[model samples]
Target: MWKHFKFDPNSVNFSCFTDEKFNKFDNLLRFEWEHAVSQDLFMFTIDYNAKQRILDDGDLNYIIGLNRDRQEKRRVPYLFEHVNIPFDNKKFHFNKIKDAEVLFSLDNEQQTDKHLIIINAAPIRPYHVLLVPYRELEQPQVIERNNLISIIFPDVANPMCLDSLCDLLLGQIIETKYVVTADCIVFGCEFVAASAHPYIVAGLNSLCAYASVNHLHLHGMYCPGRMFIQTLKCSVFHTKSNCYLLDSFQPQAFAFEVKHIDEFNKISQDVYKITNYLMLNNIAHNVAIVKGDSFSSADNVLRIFIWFRQSITNGEKFERCNFAFLELSGFMTMPDEKVYNTLTESEMCQHMNRLGLSVEEQERIKDDVKNLLDN
Candidate 1:
């Protein structure tokens, strides 16, 4: 059994997150979120007050959700124009929780150090929170190969990272319950593990990828939808494992699937090896891990999608539509109402493809990654 936070909805003081059974996490999250909203704890009240539409262009079902309120909040002066901002230069960090409410404070559990689960101040959805590991260590947004490897290997593993991923999946499974409508019909409800109710763990490696804070943290949003990346059209790229290149997707990405925990170590290594290379080369990237076969009644495989794109070195202005891990995964949040209203599928495709490497360059990258892992 995995450890879980002993959560309390009424406490302003820290609640201990320890090794308990993982049955009540979804209930805990929802309870506290409602409590926080009652106390007016968030920077903004983000009730589903935005325009949303879904566009199916043959291969992908694109969710175009516009959050006009969030767009207005981004106009703050401290917003920088560069991806590689120094830690000391930033006016904002997650070291201290402000405006948002804390759900739980994780102590030493399974040899994992301190961590925090705090609500997103500018939340995009209910139960949206940020998970910060080793808060005092003050790690940056960039991924260190050594640190990543330490998390994957059991001897030196920081299970907090892996546990966070599993928590999202497990929470989805546990949230299954029976509901009755006013019409007096009984129905079964099972939320999609990926961003449906509990949360999906997503990371943005640089500002170009819409990372607002330099401090190391992961976003857990309750985005409700079956993302297209969960089951993307793919052609096998490397014969070594379940590695494939997303076919016909803009900004070519490598997708790796992990069917069980035993396969996690090797799969994470392969995924991070490529990410490390991208970090060293000053390439911006986004990572999204979701239930691979989310739509299937019996499948529970997890898929890791990594996209390497052109770094936004100078942040003079934002991209036409900021493409982060979530956007790349198909659940897009358009801050600008105008862009959200007028954007076409073909135009969006062209823009995202241009943001990534050319077809020849991506082919070279594929070859390079295959060689790196094989040897």
Candidate 2:
């Protein structure tokens, strides 16, 4: 017999993820079918305040019936390992992570002792994996990301270096052929996104980062709905002659892309350099990595978008702040159907205005790093 889960939502450490016993494809197919017949996913709807939810078809009027009593609105939760967020305002006992099976583990071909990927049991999407640093996972501390790197690599002893970590993340990009709703994963703030089978990955630097649970993690899912992989349909953002990547710039939204090894190396190096800069200033940022497909190569092009934001130390957090990586990528997810139904255009503008970087602000950060992000 299958075991029953004992949940303690108030404990702050209880898990919100699960590895479904049913086949993932079948489950998804079933969800799609239900939308075909009834026009809703279990009556849950999401309001992407800033953007319209991508309509599966023009006829998809999947809102629940008017007579149906409104189901208690609930936002899907991130499968994080932690006690309550900044709610308690004091150290809380660690919530012992459950020993559940993950849909996938690390790629056996290139598996390493340094880090391992655990397909989230209660995942936001299929093959949704979390890269857990071993030493840190085993010993759980509010330590810097580099501390885990130094222990794993042994060569980079500096506490601030993020290269090893970056390399590991890059390797993750190489391993998987798919990423999902990065598009669908949005919580209250519509921060999550998952589309069709396209490579989408993002990372949160520390617990102080916005994700619900405060463990260092990289989020990757396949999303095909992303309209703009490269900023404004332009592949390369060059400063003057298209010889070198512009330090920081995007025509519509601030974004950049990398096509070859030399460009990727320079991009990754620029990442660590900027990360160190943010750390010095005690700021936080979100990262999104995009690829055409698993078979994509340097010639096919890969993109990694970084944008600055406030960290927990700076007293910045979205109580219900949504829109993490995928949302930042232009696709957004709203987990509550009722809210999605109710969210008006004006409210959407309000949310968009209050949160995220303004074009002017994006330009400022881009220009600020114009030299730094270029390496």
Candidate 3:
């Protein structure tokens, strides 16, 4: 199914890194990513609410005001245009780049023309693949199926169209399947306008995570963290299709799911809609994406999850509170061991609560998203 997948860079095309020589190299990527799980970093089914299970380090401060991201602006404005975009070697634009190192982007001709892949310089997990679109200058506004934000993306066709050199990056999708679980996050339009290159980030690892880059990207990490231990599963928002909207059982996060690969692009639609909702209401927000289901498995279900956190107050933004994908989905990767080791599950949970969308706001967002899917 993957060998024939589509890679469309119109908005953001899906393309596999089709190199017979890299076949073995691709396996190496999986091996390194799986090492995190081999170390047992993934969280499986367990009760988080039970006092005995949550945490014991009550003496340590939860670091509710933890502002660890040095790469991002401290006082982030609600729109992408408001922040001061970073400057690169004066010869190049900050995020607007034609070619870059493979780690930063598909920085070469062979890689760009065929299997365009960019590895993260300092990735949250090994083998984090960002499906990049080369045409950053052609920012055409695509169909606005979303009621909220009018997201611009490459036009979508089937996932297996071969006309495009890079139809899909199987490494990203396969990596997700190998782990059985993966986590991801988002940086909506305003979240990182300084870096205009658009891409989707997916990895085969995770627990507590963060969006370290402002360049528009998607995240795919492994497993739900301690924070997503109790995700809300509501069917009221279910579409006629198998797709359903999953709000984090916890208070701070909201997510929607499409159950088939055919609807994978729809995940973008939901994200744009939700981001639009947040923007329209003057609420600053961040979005994230985690692989919905294992593509390699017999489940035959391709689940794609799009989650967003609503920071409705200036205080929340001023606090530099990052309620992006990883945090909302049940984990927050602390800046250092001092914060990570000292923070117990309970404290982390408390911090997650603080970063989430309020109950009423979540409901409103869900309603709007549901309307988009049902239609």
Candidate 4:
């Protein structure tokens, strides 16, 4: 029943996961993943077969690529258009997982503090894995903000912890060979069971997202190229909070920043309140927590970008392209060569716009967010 969960002596020591330790663990993870792939444990070798290019779309320039091989190999049970799926216990979940897929387990002082680092059998990018916090808990796909942050990023309320988490993620961007993105996605499960019908999927592939497995996990993927969202400029949305709106970017999004540790509580509350409203309203959305563009060892600023978009339902005759967190964040992985080769900035913008709400609808959501925070 425990699968292959075993404490890794070299794994992160939660009591003190310094920047140096993070570097060591990253190397260890890559080594373990490569070893597993060599042994033919995974479904296929993780390769970047896509032809990539950077488009100069004025301020919203982005990295676009096509991975036709992954498109053929990866499992996509339902398209992004299928949003009203139920949480069926009969389906696969992290609670029941293959032993060989596990990288290792994180067991610190107590056995109950263990977490599983499992390889994504089918990955969108290299070095992809699910960071399952307390695998034994059998938590559902729902995102409980406080519980999630506490377990994955314990003591984040503390400035030191916040900086450490930022360094852990940013270190990947700087030291790793490939671009990386850390997305804690909530696809089909809403904060409340009553409002779950309008849930969203995070990744383009169903296995990577789309409630393929109803398990609480954070996706850590080393993408093929850098994403534009890391450096995209934004205008001030609300004069009161640290939130800023990504103006002029298709599928408008709101971003929150934490330049100083003292701003943690307020920013956390703001993110929670906004996401809570979106979930309750069944508004499909994506949350990306990454190191800020201005990040440095000296000034490690953290950023959180939230995008509330329209759910492409089954019956709707909408634009067919899937726009999840990665696509919205400006690093789209196309399903085929034609789409990748021909998707221009203007057309990409149109597709993104089609997947999102109108300006008026977004304004109303912003007002609702403001009201929630004010109360």
TM accuracy, model 2: 0.49
- Residue 268 of model 2, lDDT score: 49
1 versus 3: better lDDT goes to: 1
Q: What TM-score does each of the candidates earn?
A: 0.72, 0.49, 0.49, 0.69
Q: Model 1, range 125-221, lDDT digits (tens) per residue?
A: 6577776666566766654333221122123344468778676555545333332121000000011121223224444446566677877666665
The residue-level lDDT of candidate 4 at 26 comes to: 52
- Per candidate, the number of residue pairs that clash is 2, 33, 41, 0
Cα error, residue 254 of model 2, in Å, equals: 5.5
**Local error of candidate 1 at 227, Å?**
1.0
List the candidate 1 regions with Cα displacement exceeding 4 Å: 1-23, 56-59, 74-86, 98-100, 105-113, 145-201, 294-299, 316-320
Per-residue lDDT of candidate 4, residues 177-233 (tens digit): 321112122211111011111111122222222334555665555444445665556
Where model 3 places Cα greater than 4 Å from the true spot, the runs are 1-25, 28-100, 103-115, 138-215, 220-236, 241-245, 248-258, 266-271, 291-300, 312-322
Which ten residues in a row are the worst by lDDT in model 1?
Answer: 182-191
Go through the candidates in order and give each one's C-alpha lDDT. Answer: 0.58, 0.37, 0.35, 0.54
Q: What lDDT tens digits, residue by residue, belong to model 2 across residues 203-247?
A: 443333445444444555433344343332333444532222222
**Stretches of model 4 off by over 4 angstroms after superposition:** 1-22, 57-59, 78-86, 105-115, 146-212, 260-266, 294-299, 314-320
Candidate 2, residue 162: the lDDT equals 85
What's the CA RMSD of model 4 in angstroms? 12.9
